[model samples]
Target chain A: MKILSKLRASIAVAAVLILSAVMFVDINDAQAEYGDVVINNYSDGAGMRPVVFPHWFHRVRFRCKVCHADLGFKFQAGGNEINMVKIIDGQFCGACHNGDIAWSVENCNLCHSGKPGTPTQVHESTVQKLAQPSGAKK
Target chain B: MPVSTFRAEFLDTVSGLARGAASPGLALFLWLLCVGAAWAGEWLPLANDGIHDPRSRAVKILQQPREALQGLTPDHAGNQVRWVQVLEKGEIRPREKLFPQTVVQKLDLDVILDAKGGMPAVRFPHRPHTEWLDCVNCHDGLFAKSVGQSKISMFKILQGEQCGVCHGAVAFPLTECARCHSIPRPGQSKPVIPAGIDPRIHQAIGQGQK
Candidate 1:
C-alpha cells in the first residue's frame, strides 16, 4: 500500500510537468504568428469587403520609411481613413498602386480577396531567399 | 476532481501543514516543487525595462533639466526652455522657433481639445513632437491623421496604447497631468509660429495634399 501511494504521487507530479510544457509551447507559437494585420475600418460599413494588407510582401521590397515617411501611410491598420476616392486621387495606396509603380488599383481582388491564400508559403520562401548570402545567390 | 476543487484542497492541505498539524518542511518542499515547475517554462519577464530604465543614459538627462536645455544652440534653446518653464513654473508661454527650417517646411499647429467633464482640455503641440520624430511615428500608428477618428481614452493611454507608448517610457512620465491638460490653467497663451514658414506645410499635414 505504501509503495502504491508513492507511485501515484510521482505520476501526478509528472502529469503536471507535461501539461505545463505543452501550454508554454502553444504560447510561443501564438507570439510567432502575430505579424498579420487586418484593415477593416470602412469596408464593412461601406458595404464592401475589408482589405488585408500583407506586411511580409511589401517589407521584402521597400523600407518602412518609403511608405510611412515619404508616402505618409499611418502605422496602425485603418488609421489612415483611406477610401476609394483617395486611392483614385493618388493619395495613400494610390501613390504606389497607380499602374506605373506597382499593381494597379484596378486589381481589387489582389487585396480584397480576404482568403488565406498562399501567404504562409510565400513568406517562408521569401525568408529563405533573403536568408541566403548576397553573392552566393548569383 | 475539477482543477479549482483540487487547487482549494491542495492549498488547505498546505495551510494545515504550515499551522503545525503536519510536517512544515514537507509542505514547504511541496510549494517549492509546484512553483519551480511553473518557473521552468519559457515565459515573458514580468517587468521589461526597455528604454525606460532609470539607470539608462537617456533618463539621466532629466536629472538636470536646465543644463540639458542649455546644451542646444541659442535659437533652439529658447524652444526647449518654454517646455522647462511649463514643467517648473507652470507657465504656458507661446512657443517660438518651433521647428528647424530644413527638416520640414510647415508652421506648427496646436490641437486644442475641449474640456471633458471637469478635466482641462488637452493641448497637443505639433512642433515639439515633430522635432524629435517624423510624421509617420504617430500618424496611422499611435494617432490617426484625421482628428476625432482615433478612439482615445484615459484607459487606453494607461495600457500603453496611444500616448502611453512614449509618455511613461522615454519622453516624460505621465504623472505630470497638467503638462498635457494645459487649457484651463491661468496665464495660458496661444503658441506663436515663427515667420517665413511655408503655408503649404500646414496644408500637407492637415489634408495630405501637396
Candidate 2:
C-alpha cells in the first residue's frame, strides 16, 4: 500500500510539472522592423558618413542586378569602396550624373551638401523628388 | 495459529514486493513521459552570425577563382576555377580545371514526415549548395540548430517567404520536384531505394547529379 501510494504521489508531481511547463511556454509575437537602407561606409578617417539609402526608392527605378551586378557593387556596402570624390569624377554615382540621367556635377548641393547627421532635410527631399524622371512626362 | 500467521505474513510480503516493483515501473514511466514532453518543444537555432557573412569573407580573401579551386582540388592541381555561381540551383555541373560558370553551394533537402509525429529522414546535398550561395544565406540566420524549429511550411514557401527567398525566384523552381525527389513516379511510394534494385542511383551516377 505504501509503495502504491508513493507511486501515485510521484506520478501526480510529474504531471503537475509537465502541465505547468506546457501552460507557461511563452509565445513570443515580437517582430523587428529594420530600415531598408543598410549602409556600412569605410572611408574618411574621422569616421565615414552613414549612407542613408532608401532601397525601396531606388528599387522602384532600377533592378537589383543593375547596380549590384553591372555596377560591380560587392553586394554589401564598404566592400566596393565608394567615395564622394569618385562619384564627382563619374566613377560610382557619377556614371549617370553626367547632366543627362542625373543632376550634373555643377549641382554641387545634391548629395554632398547635407550636414551628415540629418538623414533628411528640406532640400534633400526636394532634390530627391526632382532627381527622378518619374514626374517628367516623357 | 502459528501456521496461519506464517501464511498471512508470507502473503503480505509477496504483496509488498509486487507493489514495490509496480511503483518503480510507474515512476520510470513518469520519468520517461517528462523527458519526452521536454523534448517536444525544443527548436533549431537559426541566427545570423559573423561566420555566415559571405561578402565579408569573400572580399577579404578575394582569391582568384583559379587559386581558390587549386586549393580545394588535389587531382586537378593548378586548375583555374571559373566563376562562382552566386545563388544558382541545379545538379552539380562537372568540370575539369575550369569552366565558364562555377557551381553555387546550398543544402538541398527532401523531407517526408513519418507516422507517430517522429522526424522524417531527409536526403540532403551539402557540397553543391555551398558552392552556389553564400554561407550567410542559410547557416545562422536562416536555419536554427534544431530541426523543425523554423516552422517552415509550404504555405510560407508559395508565398515567397522563408526558403522561398531564393528557391522559386533565384534557385531552381520548386515545380521541378524531381530534382530533389530523384525517384521516378513508380518509386515515389517507397522512401528508400532498395540496394541493387534502384534505378535512380544509376541515373544519378550516370548524370553526376548535375
Candidate 3:
C-alpha cells in the first residue's frame, strides 16, 4: 500500500514539473520573436498599441543600406523619432510608405499590433539561456 | 505663352537653380513645393508634381537583384543573401554616401575573436563592413577603438547589443555559424596534445589566437 502511494506521489510531482516547463516555454514564446522591435515611444502616450516592428520582414525584402544609408535610420531601437506626422510628411517611414512602395499608413493594425503598455525596445528574451557562448549552435 | 507653358517654364527655372546650388537651393525648392501644395489646399488623385512615382524604382529593385546576385553563395538566414561575400566579390557597388560629396574612406582590419573550448574563433573582417558603413556607426558606441576593451558574449549579442545592433536584425541572422565562427580551434585531431599547450603551436595553428 505504501509503495503504491509513493508511486502516485512521484507521478504527480513529475506531471507538475512537466507542466511548469511547458508553461515557461509558452511564456517565452508569448514575449516576442527574434529581431522584433516594439516601438512604444509615443504609441502609448498617444493612446494606441505599441508598434511591433518586425525587422525580419523588412530585412528579407529590403537591404539594410536602403533604410540605414539612403533613409538615414540610425541602428538602434527607440532611436528614431518616428511619428505619424513625419511619416505622412514623407520623412522617415514615409519615404516608402506613401501608398506605393508596400502599403499606405492607413492600415493601422498591421504595424501597431503589440499589446497595450509594452515598452519600446528590441524583444530579446530576458532569460539568457546557457549564459555562456553558444555561438556554435545553429 | 499659354498658362500651362508658363508654369512649366517656371518649374524648369526653379529646378535648374536647385541643381546648380547646394542644400540651401534644394531646401528652397522643397519649401516652394510645400508652399504651392498649401496654396492648392486640396489633394490631386493623379498627382504629377506633389507625389513621387515608385513604378520604375520598384521594378528596378525587384528585377536587378536576380541578375546582380546571380552565381553568389546563398545564406541560410536573414536576407538569405551572403552580403559580405556579395560586397567582397564586388557584385554590387552601393554608394557609401547619400550626397556623394563627402568621400568615403575604406579601411581594412582583422578582428580575431579567440577560440572557445568547443567552437572556432570568429574572424571579423573590417574591409567589407567599412565599404558599406562609416566608422562612427559602430565605434565608441557598439565597439571600442581596440579589441579587449569591450566584453562581447553571446548573451549580450542575442539581446541585440554590441554586434547584435546589425547582425540578427538587418545584416544577417545568427543561424549562420560557420560564417563568423570560421577560425578553427587549435589541433582538431590531436596526437596526445599536452594540457598546457605550447604557445608556438598556437601561433602556428591558430595564427592570431596569441
Candidate 4:
C-alpha cells in the first residue's frame, strides 16, 4: 500500500510537469497565428458592421509607403476619421477604391460583413497561409 | 502531544489526503499554481521597478549610442564629438543590420530643393539617412512620399518640424548651413568650405581672410 501511494504521488508530479511544459510551448504558437485589424470607427453607431482589414492581403501586394505616404492614411488603426460621405466624395479609401482602380463603394456587404459576435464567413488566402510561422498547424 | 509529534502528524495527514483523495488533475493544477507563484516572485519585483517597461528600456538603449561610439576611439576620448569620421571608417553598425538577414533595398535618391532667398539649394541624400533610420520615420508623417506633396520651408524646420526633428538634437546642428548648402564657390572645385564643421568657426575664418 505504501509503494502504491508513492507511485501515485510520482505520477501526479510527472503529469503536472508535462502539462505545464505543454502550456508553455503552446503560448508562443498561439500568438504566431495571422492577425487582422478590425476597423469599426463609426460602423456600429451608423447601423453598419465593422470592416476587417487583413494586413497580410495588403502587405503582399503593396509596400507600407504606398497607402500610408501616398494616400495620407494614418499609421494607427482608427486614427483616420473615415465616414461614408468622405468615402463617396473620393477621400481616404475612396481615392483608389472607386470601381475603376479597385472595387466600387456600392458593394456594402463586401466591407461591412457583420458585427463582432455574429457568424461571418472569412476567406482564407493561400499567400497568408504560406506566410505563417513554421510549426503552426493549419 | 509534543510540537515535533504534532507537526509530523499534520504532514502525514496532508500527504495521505493528497495521495488518496486528490486526483492527478488537481495535483497538476496545484503544482502549476506553485510554479506560477515562484515565477511571479522572481519577475514581479523587476517589472514593478519599471525595468520591464518597453519605453524606459528603449530610452536606456538609445542613451548608449554616444557611449558605444566613444568606446572605439582613444584620441576623441570624452571630447566634443562628430560621427562623420566613425561613419566614413565604417565602424558604426546600425542595430537593425545585426539581426538575421533581411533583404532591404537601399535607394540612393537625391532631392534638390530650390533655395528661397538665393541661398544654395539643399541637396538631400536619401542613402545616408536611410542607413541609420527606417523609411517610416520620415515617409508618411513628417514628409509625404509623393513628390511636391509636402510644403517644406526653412521657417517650419526652424520651428522644430520636418528636418529639425533630428538635426538640432542628434545630427549636426542647423547652424552648420554649408553642410547642406553644398554650392561650389566661383573659383573653387569644392564648396570653398569643408562640410561638417561649425559654420560660426567658418565665418570667423572668412572674416580673417578678408
Q: Which ranges in model 2 have alpha carbons more than 4 Å from their true place? A: A1-35, A38-49, A105-138, B1-210
Chain A: TM-score in each candidate? 0.60, 0.45, 0.70, 0.61
How does model 3 fare in lDDT? 0.57
Q: For residues B1-210, what per-residue lDDT tens digits would candidate 4 score against the true structure?
A: 222354356456555555675465555444555455334222112112211222222223222222332333211111113344444455543233312353444568998776665455678888767654558768788999987788988677655468865554334445555567665434544433445544432332232110
Task: Give candidate 4's total backbone clashes.
Answer: 0
Instruction: Provide the lDDT at A56 for model 2.
Output: 26
| For model 2 chain B, the run of ten residues with the poorest summed lDDT | B73-82
Q: What fraction of the reference structure's interface contacts does model 4 contain?
A: 0.01
Error of 4 at B107 (Å): 1.6
DockQ for all models: 0.03, 0.02, 0.04, 0.04
Fnat for each predicted structure, in order? 0.01, 0.01, 0.05, 0.01
Off by over 4 Å in 4: A1-138, B1-79, B97-103, B184-210
What lDDT score belongs to each candidate, Candidate 1 first? 0.46, 0.38, 0.57, 0.49
Clashes of 2: 20
Model 4 misses residue A18 by how many Å?
Answer: 77
Candidate 3, residues B1-210, lDDT tens digits: the string is 222354456577677776676444343544466345333322122112111122223222222223333344444333335666665666555545434465566679989988555667788888778766767677787889898888889778877688766776656555445566776666754222236744322223332121
Candidate 3, RMSD to the unseen true structure = 23.7
Q: Show the colliding residue pairs in model 4.
A: none
lDDT of 4 at A116: 34
